[model samples]
Target chain A: MRFISQTSSDGVTEQLFTLPATSGDIPGVLWTPDGATGTRPLILVGHGGGQHKQAPGVVAQAHRLVTECGFAVAAVDAPAHGGRPRSTEHDRLIGEMRGRMQAGGDVAPVLAELHALIAGQSVPEWRAVVTALQELDHVGAGPVGYRGLSLGCALGVPFVAAEPRVRAAVLGLHGAETSAEAAARITVPVEFLVQWDDELVPRATSLALFEALGSTEKTLHANPGRHGAVPEFELDSAVRFFTRHLS
Target chain B: MRFISQTSSDGVTEQLFTLPATSGDIPGVLWTPDGATGTRPLILVGHGGGQHKQAPGVVAQAHRLVTECGFAVAAVDAPAHGGRPRSTEHDRLIGEMRGRMQAGGDVAPVLAELHALIAGQSVPEWRAVVTALQELDHVGAGPVGYRGLSLGCALGVPFVAAEPRVRAAVLGLHGAETSAEAAARITVPVEFLVQWDDELVPRATSLALFEALGSTEKTLHANPGRHGAVPEFELDSAVRFFTRHLS
Candidate 1:
């Protein structure tokens, strides 16, 4: 599919490229917003659980960030989602999502030291995703960030904290299957947008994470809505949070 | 599964009961509330597409109506949903609801018989659903109103417009699929909780129904939310809405 082009406020254009999956030759779109400031701030977006990266709502927002916000957004089409290899096991897998439940997320894995695909999150891979993002910022134009919705939100925080290059993050409509291990590791500036009333993800677990984040700079944008919510985007709040920290 | 129990203001205790479908049975629930002033306004809560009535969220809301706020709520598990019949052919026909595609939400049939559900809607089963609600209401209480979420919200309004006992309605998180159809046949008081910023249900379509409702008494309780919403339970706005209309 053709990843549409968008125009940013800085008078340059944004281009959609593909990040071929390392596991397989699957192709996922990576939207590169041009005209980024000197030392570009990278923003890598991720997919929600049980959904692909190009799901309509996610795509709309990706387009908006590239076009309206002028941010370099690498929207990952993770394994088993978007253009990556299909996950044969999820449909038949055991109940609930856990690290043990299923796998396939955009991360730099180190063990293989082989092709980027087939890599595990063996410390090195995590560093690689962050390293690549930082390099891209210098190549693309400075302060890089990360954000995700739903499952993406669940993974984005830890990934951001692990990779020092990611200055901040905006996690939206997330809270399902939160990892306390991941929670403890999140020491960077972070914000959570949760539909506390949503049933898709356990709200209590998210509240627990909110309280547990190591950073005193944490904030929670609670939308009194349901799951998979697009209506309560809280764009201004998110933009403000990112701008305050990223700048 | 178990239904929730609640106590009313006048010290009346009631149990929420679901009508089971035993091969030849109609499935529904009678959720009794307290402080009946001679006759209390009853609300027939409808389930969304391809979902059972007794799902955890539905059951919890039934409790809220019965216990927290005083309103008699009767929810039905529609055919092919909940403890209802399922056919391989019908299941295939229901289509998959994932990533912005839900099967069988068309309103062409619903508009054909603007005055009713059975003849007008594309399918006869939903009309049967309307009849089931009416029959159960008559058996359990005097008169009742209607409330539905998502697909149910789209179907319930027309059903209530035709059923006189339905004094008021709160159509949650849905709008007429087509604009021309939405323009026709609305007479009762309605509170259209239009999700002004919703991503799942496009904003334009919702605006169409809001503009079409001819009832001067109709009010719009538009929220910044999405489709998978339980209006009467989680949100304080929902509780307030029920308080004003149902009481």
Candidate 2:
């Protein structure tokens, strides 16, 4: 993993980290609070596409999980981004699968990556995230949780759905609409944050996705700020939401 | 440096690159439109503090820049952030200059970091970026511009302050008052993008800086997003702003 340690003028320090990608790499970093030293709730964070684990979606969560929520974090790189240096391997797989699909009507590459991710997810590569969460507890000084923004939301939903370990989940700028069918399967208590005036991703897209979630214990946060405002929320609600559900 | 990777189901690939800090480390990646290479103005990008170079800021920017202006870009890690990890390392020679108040009384750590970064800003870093832009130019590409959000804006303003290289500059969610001072020093035109509500740093603070710059060629973009929303412009004004200045 690559790391960037940032110290603000206020003397506060933050270390930005990037994870390496293999054939199916998830880019992200784990953030530990200062002086933290025990197993805490782990936040398996996912970032949007075109963004790596070190983007705001992941970085801001690093602070929220460590400081505000008192949890350890593991920010993972989403597909075709930060972790894999462009998911070239995935792209190649995609091409191969696409060719096969064209010939056999099967999404071979897509299924391969997602299934491998899911199969190994509970294990390293995928499952290693869970192990890392436990590690965060050992190193983070406490518990763990889950957080995702935009595309990261997509990854978190599925990961948490398959693994019942994640206590709470926060989805920002994305919703069940990313894959309504897939979203319906997720039973985790999730917090959906939306920016109504977002020009990039229409607000309705997120709203539709939120409505599609099968999870009954869900809360929606409406902020006037665009997708950029995810970090502004005290995130207390998310913490509380996760705390209520996770442990 | 640690590396992280992830890929999308469809076929998007990215690598989480952590550039180590030791003075000679420069890792910059360019997102050139499918096929193109020179003469296109290069867009030099800087991410926010604790954020990696190829983060959502740039991820979002790449999509927006390509869509709005048909431009190519080179995004890089700033000091102590992303691949190059380190807070500002104080050299006794420069650290002693802390006693010297060129900007204000005593020394502001932010300023110190900024100074260190600028002094050490390598030709290799800038040159690699320029090379990427040229590669884009080899094909048919549009004029190049610069844009930075948060700390990116902070570093960017000073970056373009004295350069005649860039055709225009777009800095968002930066301090308006300090920027006013910076704009006064810059020879090129600047379009400052500000959010309607930015809590991390007061919105008014940046507004005051904008009011201070008073550049005849200067323009301001007020949006409905937060500090992180700079990359997601809600209006067509950003495109218009860049066009007016680039041409």
Candidate 3:
């Protein structure tokens, strides 16, 4: 891992970095308390589709976790998002999804295909990110958590299922179509969110995904809203959830 | 309203009281911070089936709201519950429900019938109780919240729908079979709980009840457990929910 830039504000230190990977170097960002010296619980946030490591929502959540819970936070660009290069296959799938959505056709099949494609590469990338981040002085592996929704959740299910380092997760805004088998393998405590009137994902599929989770401690929080309109109180709940498990 | 007894412990003041009604005196209990002065948010908790105003769960929730949030909390015995007298109709319904369950028959119809019978009286009783309690110096007309599940929810659905004083509610553990129309009339913020493996209420019906609620701000919290096994964390969530809307 190589640090590219560093800045501090509101008692949180933000650092931009890159980790060498088999495909190429992966761009990422980390947040920690200003002048931190000891290891702390680390939270890895995965941004939604078309969003990057430093999306507004991701940054806000990272800051809150750092300032309120005193945890280190990190986010990495997914395979074809952020500053990463997209393959011809990525372009083809994106074009097909956009065309179908514009025609008012069901996008579930395309979404599942897109997620499967991304997860194959992103899962191992996430594992490597956890290993690299944990080795840092201020982010030593005390415990790790994951926060993701939408496209993030689509990729997160398999990652959390395969990665034992993740002790807990807050995931949702996706469906069971692509992730049910992976979700069934996850046993850590999970908080799954669902938008009751979600336009992109079918409500039944979201509920089905929650039902498919193997975690004995999973909780579903469904709010009345569209795909992007999760209520603010849920963020507070997620903070308490991670604090309970990781702290 | 007449105070029958008063006690103080752990910084929470508990008072037992009864309100005069046409049928009889409606028994109730109230909790507030010791030496509390001025009007504050009040939460009325309706105990589950077979439980009373001072049931362990009811008392624990009341004390937490009082001590932690400095809110006044109250609960009253439902019709045919606690110290209230059960009519021949109540006896018949109870007998039928128990017999159906023992014989491995579906109990939803019987339970619904029982709830309908009880709610007819309890809804008006709850309104009178709220009117009487809010007249107290410490309780005075303030934003009121309601918490109830199972039979309490069956009764609460209609009560909260009709009582404009109730600004918010946490209700679940029953189904829409008997309360869908009433639920559609409730417009306040609500937190609905669902026990994923509930033995008494079918999961689909619980989801249907949540779906039937007309509140734009309603949220559903589903945990992996049976009807009687709501996790302790939900109580904490409820406290925050009331505090957010009330205070």
Candidate 4:
């Protein structure tokens, strides 16, 4: 793990870094309270599809977690997303998905395939990142949480299922088609969100994904809106959820 | 409205009262911060079927809203429940419902019928009670919220829809069979709850009721439990919901 740049604002510090990996150097960012050190609960935030680690929503969430909960937050670029180089296979899958969506054809199968391909690489990268992040003097090994949606949720279902270090998760905006089996393996507490009228993900599939989660303590929060219109109050609710489980 | 008794505990004052109605005196209870003497948001809590105005859950929620949010809270006993006389027709429906449950038969139709019969009287009773309560000094006219579940939800749907004074509501635990039409008429913000494994209400019907709500700002919070096992966290969420809309 290597730190590339650091900045501070609004009492939250943001650090950009790169972690050496088998695939290549994985770009990532971490957020913490400004001028502070020592261990605290850390949250791993996964960005939506076509978004990078520092997307506006991701940064806003990171800042809130750091400032409100005093929690360390981190995000990493997916294999073919952000500053990562896309392989020929990645380009082919992306092209197919875009073509199908533009032509009003079914994109579920292809989307699932794309998520599966990315998850294979991203999952290991995440594991390695957690190992390194926790080793930092300022973010020692502590209970970890995950916040992800859409593409992030597609990848997160499997990651949370396999990763025992993750204590809880807030996930949604995706369907069960590609994540049900993995979802069934997750036992930690989960806070799942569903957009009642999500245009990209069918409502039944989103409900099905919530149903598939094996967590004994999972709660589903469904709001009336399109895929991107999750009300702002939900962000407040998520802060409370992580504080309850991780802090 | 006439006060029957008053008690203060833990910085909250509980007052038992009754409002003169054409049908009979409507028995109710009100809670507010001790020494409160000005207009504030008032939340009318409707008790569950077979439960009274001061049922344990109802009292706990009322206390939270009063002590934490400084809001005035009130609850009235439903007809055929909690100090209210049961008509022969009410007795017949109750008997049929209990018998069906013992025989492992479906009780949806009978329950709906019972709800419809009670709602006809309770809706107007609620309106009258609200008018009379808002006339009090501490509980002067202000934004009003409603919280109810099970039979309370069955009655609340119609009451909230018809009572324009109600600005928001937190309701669930019943299904759509009797409430869908009224739910469609409710345009205020709503926080709807659903017990995922509810033994009394079908899951699909609860989802349908949520879907039928006309409120563009409605949110559904579903947790894994039986009909009566709503998690405690939800009460906290309800407090936040009401605070956001009412205050």
Candidate 5:
């Protein structure tokens, strides 16, 4: 991993970085409080699909973690998304899915394939980044936590399951057998946020994912609305959750 | 709805029945003790994917419900499986899924689509069967329960959710957004069974589905094995669950 540039704003130091991986060059941003002094807990913030590492929500989350919680935050662009060259196959498959759905065709196979394609590459890249971060003396050996929503949950589940560095996570917006299996391996404290009537994700799927967490101390915070409408209070709770567990 | 035939064997009286629906003639069987008289609790058993109403497991469960639990049992073939005429679309999709997987392709979208296709037809058909059964004075309207494993759980989740007659259910071996959503609508008592290392169904998915159940009184029976290796002890417990909740 190599730092590309650094910018300072509102007592937050933001640095752009890139990690060379088999998948490609993974670009990301790391946020730290100005004069953060010694090592502090590192919170990895993940973004939703169609969004990048510095998506407004992700940036806000990083800002909050550094300013309010006094924790460093990091986020990387998922492969085939944000700052990465798009795959022709990925675009073709997505087009095929839309066409098939419109034609009243079965599309589960394609969705599964897409998940596998992205996750197969994304999880490993995240792990490499985590390893690289751990080697930095200033980043500390303190606890690490992850917070991702939707697509982030999809990627974070497996990533956290495989990375021992992640001691706690705030995840939700996606659930499946694969994610559930990954969740079963997560014995860390977890805070799951669910949108009760999420248009894309059924409530049961989210609930089931929450139930699958191996953590003895996991909490489910559900609110009413569509996929993107997770209440701000829930976000606050997640921040507190990370603070309580990681700090 | 019409009864096709009635046969008595092993102290259990089996009546093959059919219900006409938009999908086609829905074939089913109802089992009761040979000497059963008056109205007893009724258990609606659901068979799994690729299996018919009289699959060995389904039959055994019916037999147990009638002979041991002293309750009536009923089940029907899901659309495109068993006695039902297989759809060209379903066949084509299955072939496509197989081909895709063999080619190292993702198949989640296809799986989801296939599930939606069957559940779309199966849930409504089950609801219709429930209505038809309720009209039969001989069937009696005592508390009703459901028993389905694997594919059965997939069908039963939505079936039980929509059919208010189902006061209790034995559901597991499948977890998805559709099942989860349907599970959230269920308020009846439930006893869920899980195969820990189910090759087809992940343990996390099963656990999540169990957690999603809206029933206030729910029991989870987990065993060590694959999808088809549900232990006999769990079956015995399900019979007791029906006896307690329905009888």
Candidate 6:
């Protein structure tokens, strides 16, 4: 990965970078709390679908992890999202699927297949970013944790499932049906959040994804609201969850 | 399949029957319009998870198909649910999966594996039910169509994909991630219903399933509600869809 820019504000350093990827290059941002000397916990924050590493939610969460929780944070643009160059085929498929859905058809399989394809590409990019981070000075040597939104959950489940370095996770705002098989591979502690009345995801599917995890220690935190209405209190709870487990 | 009883009410004749199977016997209900003519469109109705063939929704839908749409309808109990004797293994797995979800772990893989196994059995049973229905005088010899609910979509996707006799389908109230490849084989017209605010299925996943269908003509009818909150008007829409395609 090559750093594109570095800026510091409010006792935190934010570095924008791009990493060579099989599909071309992956854009990302990493946040590190200022005045930190040695090893500390590293948290990966995944953004929602149609978003990127720089999305407000991702930046806010990463900022919280850095400033409040004293951790380094990293995030990457998922395929067809953010600053990453889009594939015509992917865009076409997504467009077609969305159109069909608007017309009253079931196109979930196509979306899932596309998600899996992107996830397959993203997991490696994440691994590479982590490796690049480890080479930097003043970075953490502690356990790695993950916090992902809906699209994040979709890719993060399988990514966390495959990466043994991800010791704990906070996943929510998405149903687990797409990554159920990968969920079974997650043996680490997890904090799953769900909006009881999610407009975009089904409650049973979310619960089922939680059930698919092999982790012996996992907690479900359900709140009443729509998909994007996650309570601000929950972010604090997630910070605590990672602190308790990763730190 | 052997007939157990027949009752007529509201211009519809409901027949109760049991079909021999490896698990013992599968109980089913078939609804035919009273004073029915020969060779009318036949629609196979598949119930939701945890519901019997005689569940109110299943019966009500069947009655409407028979009395209003001039179609014959049939439904059977899924293995380990309703009249079919539960397998200790199935119950144990479900219990374990549910327990894990309650503990905030992911158990979607287990549920999916179980769903696949049951779909394998249910598909054959559905085929046999159709064959048995063919021998009866009240049932029709016309084009065959399928209408499956949540669990029904889980099993029905593969069933319809494999059964060439089923010319059209109405599937939804579930995601098609588990049956994407099978969905790709369904080239007939379809009308898929989804609750935009479904608690167990995700909107994108539902759209993906619709995209996966091989059908050149498929319609999606998404209502704003929870998993079980499908509007009554959608059923009427489904009946019209099937009637236009099958009749």
lDDT of 3 by residue, B191-222 (tens): 99999999889999999999999999999999
lDDT of 4: 0.95
- Write the residue-wise lDDT of candidate 4 on B83-170 in tens digits: 9999999999999999999999989889989988999999999999999989999999999999999988999999999999999999
By TM-score, is 1 or 6 better?
6
Per-prediction TM-score: 0.41, 0.39, 0.99, 0.99, 0.50, 0.50
Tens digit of lDDT per residue, candidate 6, span A148-189?
Answer: 979899988988998888899998776766888999999998
Q: Poorest 10 consecutive residues of model 1 chain B by lDDT?
A: B114-123
> Comparing candidate 3 with candidate 6, which one achieves the higher lDDT?
3
Query: Tens digits of per-residue lDDT for model 1 on A138-196?
Result: 23436666677666765565566566666777765654234455556766776666664
Which TM-score values does chain B get in all models? 0.67, 0.68, 0.99, 0.99, 0.93, 0.95
Per-model C-alpha lDDT, please? 0.53, 0.56, 0.94, 0.95, 0.80, 0.82
Candidate with maximal DockQ = 4
For model 4, give the TM-score of chain B: 0.99
Per-residue lDDT of candidate 3, residues A1-247 (tens digit) = 9999999999999999999998688899999999998899999999999999999999999999999999999999998999999999999999999999999998888878888999999999999999999999999978999999999999999999999999999999999998999999999999999999998889999999999999999999999989999999899999999999999
Rank the candidate models, highest lDDT first.
Answer: 4, 3, 6, 5, 2, 1
> What's the residue-level lDDT of A48 in candidate 3?
99
Instruction: State the lDDT of candidate 5 residue by residue for B24-78, as single tens digits.
Output: 9999998888867677788888887778989898898888888887788888988
- What lDDT tens digits, residue by residue, belong to model 6 across residues B112-209? 88898788789889888888887777675678999997888998999999888898898987776687889999898787776766877887788678
Report the Cα lDDT for residue A139, model 2.
Answer: 48
Evaluated with lDDT, which candidate comes out highest?
4
lDDT of 1 by residue, B71-91 (tens): 666676655567756656444
Could you report the DockQ of all the candidates, in the order they appear?
Answer: 0.02, 0.01, 0.95, 0.95, 0.02, 0.01
**TM-score between candidate 4 and the true structure:** 0.99
Cα shift from native, residue B105, model 6 (Å): 3.1
Model 5 lDDT per residue over A1-247, tens place: 8999999999899989999998889998899888766778999988997899999999988888898988888999988889898799889877888998899787656766777789899988887877787666656667899999898998888888888989999988886645788889988877777776687777767778887888766655555568998766556667777887888
Native contacts retained, all candidates in order: 0.00, 0.00, 1.00, 1.00, 0.00, 0.00
Q: After superposition, how far is residue B10 of candidate 6 from its true place, in Å?
A: 0.8
